[model samples]
Target: MWTTLITLAIGAFGAVAAFWLGIPAPFLTGPAFLVTLCGISGIRVAIPARLRDVIFLIIGTNMGTAVTPEAVATAGKWPLSLIILSLCILAIFLIGARLLQMWFGMDRMSALLTATPGHLSFVIGLTDDLKADISRVTLISSLRVLTLTLLVPFIAPLLTGEPLPRLAPATQPMALPALAAILILATALGLLFQRLRVPAALLLGGMAVSSLAHAFSITEGSVPQWLSLPAFATMGALIGTRFGGVSFRMLAQAMGASATLSSFAAIVSLAGAYAVSQLFGIPIVTVLIAFAPGGLETMMAMSVLLDANPAYVAAHHVFRLVFLTLVLPIVVSRNR
Candidate 1:
């Protein structure tokens, strides 16, 4: 309890720094940076696994509320586009993993996990379960996520040759009762998915239930801001704490490799975004945000900040995450 409070307080400071520095999605990114700094400096900071899972549930419910019938309709036209985009994203990780294997002399498991664009928590959890080189995988994955967070807003426009729109505040707010129902439904489904051994089950299950509720008109509007801020802070702390066991030398080396892979990923994301936009007639910025290899919250927050279609962005990210969960373990099994 005290530990959680201390972490959140530190995260609040990071959020302020990110805001003052004009970083996109300052609430998450800012705290992430500060906590990570403390983590590597030997400061004791932790968020228990149970608390982390609850935070995932909160974020999942929030993102799921973005899935209205209209959002579902928009996504319905995206099957082909999603297929192609998934292939491209898969190629990026495979090729990037190969590069890491060859250059860094890393084991197949470590390289593959490091190169994956799956959700950060999901990847970290898998690393622990698989007994992979957690230090290496954690460092590389953290660098990739942090790099994308800092770089995508600035570089995505250049890559897509499209200007970002001005920030517009989101207008939808779900009723408190409806929000409660969504949370209950998500928690129930999350337990079921966990029983089925699904990856990131809490998040995906909650998202599934929330999407269903909104798509069927059982509820409407987005998750309230009052609930969202703390969830975001919790997520930031989780990412920062992942640095706990990684050495500075290993982190430095991984950062160098992560920069190269991130550059490649940015180009792939840009090209894929352009192609998918042409195929589906969605806005380029929207496609880019959906396909960018950042965490779900970071990208969704960017959509809100840039006045892009948050629902559309959220849908694509949810799809990517669902797809990765189904496929990543299979890939890992084969590599082993």
Candidate 2:
């Protein structure tokens, strides 16, 4: 459709502009801001959800390449930080839900779903089945992502008191035979996870399979530039499309509350990041980006942009998503 083409053009412009201006994660921040402007203006633009899943598969495959044998060994020490991260996730969930309930007078189901940090689509999908406030849940979830995506780059440097590392674009290419084998394995695993009803199964499954192959010296190199770059661009477009039906008036009234709660979540994320950094000897900023409560793809893109460990960042986000998806539903169901 013409509208979709126009939307992509606007996103492309944003990406070029951001890169020209040297903003952090230009590909993501640019398209997200531009498409959000188009969406809020009532423009009819969209990206199919199925395409977004394909992008995630590519990103997951790319991230898995970072999992060398030593990285797998290091993961043995991740249990402590991961456990702390889980508790931090719980705190964020409870605090956010309570704030939404107390300040906005939202019911338990809506508040709990809206307060959850990730799995935006799955939570929104529950609205009709649970008779929750679809508008409030969508708005709050959208705001959380937009707020974090726009703010994290600025906040990250300040919190870590260090300059962001130089950009590192992966340029290596895997042979066609190796690439085909890796894709087949990853895709099969992704499909299997989907059958098991796992949240972000496509991403985590692909990542797990790819990581295993690489760790065992099966796959030789990274995902091709052709696949990875487009995946990143499409991911950016998806983030921007989130604002499609949101109104300025709705955001105006909820801005204060949402902003406060989002800030609290950010602070909590940073605290957890610091703890994990100290405990694991990783850079504070790296861990901070890893623990950032944004989309797994977006945060991993940030890690790639900031020259952080994308595998580590992806692992934390995947865990956060799975844990939230599993626990949030139960909590809401009990309260209801």
Candidate 3:
């Protein structure tokens, strides 16, 4: 416990120092400290495994509210655009993974999975399950997420301007009875999807139901804003904990390669998103969230911060996660 506290203090100090020095450190304010804390204390903070599911539910609920009938109608009109964007992102990751594999001489499967800029825990767990050089994969994926999280905020504002617009104020808060009903409905939907073995379905399904309710004008009040932020912060902190488990030698080796690959990946991803945005006539910030190679939580946080279309951004990342998980393993198997 003492060590954990000290490590966290050190990480906090480091973050401040990095900011003062104008260093491009990504995890400094988020998971980086938790990683340090865990390293020093050798103590694991065991958040219930179910917490991720809950966080997803919160995210889904928030997102669902944003998808009005108008947005859905717009989406339907240009469904092909979303499909193309999703495919383009997957292609970029595949190419990037191949390039990294060549550079690092790691196994193709390990490199591919690790190089993927998806959810950190999901990637880490999948890579481990596949027995694919967990250290290398974790290192690369972590660096990718860290780089995107740090860089996107700075770049997003420059492209989209600072002080982005917020959604209009919601109507009167839902009464207690109404709020309870909504929760019950969401919970029920989540359970139904879970039983069906949908991937991240509980959260996604809950969000979907809630979103439909709002779209149809059934709920005047949206999910509370506070729900998303704290949960996302917790997710960020949990990601940082992974760094704590690394040995000094492993850390040094991973840092150099991870940094190079991540920088390259971010550049490629940003370019792809920009091009797509121009072509689709969508706001560039939306493209960035769609293309940014990071966790859903990080991207969603940025969506809120930048006042970009949070629902759109969240949808894109979620789509990417689902897409990559389904496709990458198959791709790896074929290649091997």
Candidate 4:
């Protein structure tokens, strides 16, 4: 308990420092960088699971406000990009599996599970049931998310060549009564998705409810900054906690594997994004976010930060998860 508090304090310091330094996505990246250092240095850091869920719900609900009439009109442009996105995930999965097997000394099952993009909870469950090395999979996957979280902000700007737009939070925040009612409905639907084994259930539920409300003008304002700022910080801190209890030596052993897989997957994502951008006239960077092979929660949160098309980015990620769910077992079973 004390450790968690200390970790959060360190994370808070990181957030303040990043904001002071004018770093992009300060609230999200600051704590993540600092807490990750603390974690790698062998400190005990943690974010409670419930708090993590709150982060998801708030961010997801906030994302719903990005659904505008313009975004709706762009729906026609998404199918081509999504189709390219499907191919990108396949390339990442197949090449990543082979890369791990060839260079990292990981067995097929371990490599396959480690290389599979997104769906960490589902992959970990498979590791246990399939008798693969849980630690290796966890480490590699965590490293991927951490590395992307740290690198994307800096790298994405270079790729896009356009200054990020500043979209202020809504002037009027959601009413307390409406916020509470929305959360209750989101949580109820989230629980239903959880029972059905859906990935990012709480997030999707919040997004679904909020999107519907905003679409119909039932909800009048966005999630408040008071809630969102802390949520982003907590998210960054939670990301850093992914490395807690891991040794430097163990991390060193996995870094090469993680880096190789991460680079390859990123390349595939970039390529697909470029193709879609050409085909559809969408910003390459926005398409890149949609194609990024990272956690749905994290990527969606980043989308909110970047002010990308939430409906577009969220749709691709949700599709990626569904695609992975249906295809992973078949790929593994056939190979085995």
Candidate 5:
């Protein structure tokens, strides 16, 4: 309990420092950077599964709040963008896996799982079943997520020519009754999704339910800043915790591979984003945030930072995740 408190405190402090320094998306970058340092320095940082799930519920519900009728109208372009996103994911996985195999001499299974963008937990869990290299997979993946988390805030502004404020602006808060209703429904739906073996089940469930409610004019308010800011902080901290128990030597060895793969995935994602933008008239920044090969949670946070339509951005990411969930299992079975 003391350890959890200390770890959370550190994450909070990181947010304060980042905000004080006027960094964009401070609640995210700050906690992510600091707690990652704590994890690597062997300072002992851990977020319990229950607490983590609660954070997801909050963030998922918050994201749902951003759904307006205008956003629903804009979603018409999503199918084409989603098709393009699928192609990008395929490119990143196939090319990256081959690179890992050729350059690092990683085994086929390990390389394949390692090359998979996002869906880190799924990959790691499969490592044991497939007898793959958990250490290699974890090291490369941790770096990829961390690199993207730290990189996107700086990159999104430069790419979009839109300057994000250092702090997210306050909005009207959600009514408690409505909030409770959404959460209860989200939880029920999330559990159903989870039982069906869906990735990001809770988050997706919350988003789906919340979007429905918002679209129906059931509620019209933003997630309270007090709830959102800390949830964002926790999301960042979760990224950093990926480094806990990782060895420095392993991190160093995987650096080149992770960097190369991250760069390649980003380039492919950028190209796909560009193509979708041209085809559908969506902003490249928004598409990129959706199509970026980062984790769903990290990219969701980036969507908020980019001030893009959260529903539009998150839907693509959810598709990417759900697509990966289906694809990864097939590859594993085929290779075996």
Candidate 6:
């Protein structure tokens, strides 16, 4: 118990430091501290099994509640637009990855997958399986996320000065019965998805089920803001943990190539987003989050902080995630 308390305190302090230093919000302190604790003790601290479940549940619930019927209606009208935009983004990444591979003489699969700009772990795992250069891939992927997280929040404001509207705060206290129903439903959905081997099942499936409930007017209560705080913190900490095992020697070797790939990817993504924004008549911030090469948690936090449409931002990024995952292997194989 005492160890847990100490861990929590350290995590909080790290988060506070990051925030003060103008690090992107959704500060990830928990994972950072866990990594630190592991380093200090020379033993891995087992994350309570329940904690992982809770994190995914929270993520799923938040995502599920985010989408409203209105958002769906808007998406329906421009069905082909989202598809076209996603394909364009995927193509850009593939081309950029190939260029980097040729320039740096890096492993083709690793460079291609690292430039995917979606889930880092998934990309890393796939690259490793393909016997690609894990070190270079990991470095470039991490740098891509970090660069995007830092750049978008600063650049977005310049492009879209007017803050987006926020979700109105809940006024009435949530009834216990409604909250209980939501939990039960979300849990069942998450379990089903897990059983079915769905990707990020807990998050994606839970959110889908919860959103369906919301749309059907089965649950009108909003997710308690308190629940989201830890979820975001956990996400941030996990991102920071990626740095724990990295060495200066490895980073030094990869730095030039990583920087070049990251910069090129960012520029192309931003330009694609700009063109899409004009074509679709959507807000620029939405385009930015959709095309921004970073973690989902970081993008969502920026969406909230910038007062942009969280649902739009979430949808856009999710769209990209799905797109990249599906198209990357096919593109790489064809080109090879």
Per-residue CA lDDT of candidate 4, range 104-222, in tens?
A: 88999899999998888878866655868899999999999888777777767788776553233445788989988888899999889989988888988888898888888887787
Question: Each prediction's Cα lDDT score?
Answer: 0.76, 0.78, 0.63, 0.84, 0.85, 0.63
Model 2's alpha-carbon lDDT is 0.78
Q: Candidate 6's residue-wise lDDT over 201-265, tens digit each?
A: 66655567767877787776556766665665565444544555566566667767777877776
Query: What TM value does model 5 have?
Result: 0.95
User: What local lDDT score does residue 27 receive in model 5, on the 0 to 100 scale?
Assistant: 91
lDDT pick, better of 3 and 5? 5
Summarize candidate 3's per-residue lDDT along 233-288 as a digit string, tens digits. 44555456656656667777777667767676667777777776777677887777
Specify the poorest-scoring 10-residue window by lDDT in model 4.
Answer: 162-171
Cα displacement (Å) at residue 170, model 4:
5.6
TM-score each candidate: 0.83, 0.91, 0.77, 0.95, 0.95, 0.80
Q: Write the per-residue lDDT of candidate 2 for residues 24-83, one digit (tens) a residue.
A: 777777888889888888886688767767777877887777777665666776778788
Q: Local error of candidate 6 at 276, Å? A: 2.8
The model with the greater TM-score, 3 or 4, is 4
Ranking by lDDT: 5, 4, 2, 1, 6, 3
lDDT of 6: 0.63
Name model 3 segments beyond 4 Å from true: 1-46, 119-131, 163-174, 226-228
lDDT of 3 at 127: 59
Give the clashing residue pairs of candidate 4, or none: none
Worst 10 residues of 5 by lDDT: 300-309
lDDT by residue (99-151, candidate 5, tens digit) is 98898898889889988989998888887778787887888888998888887
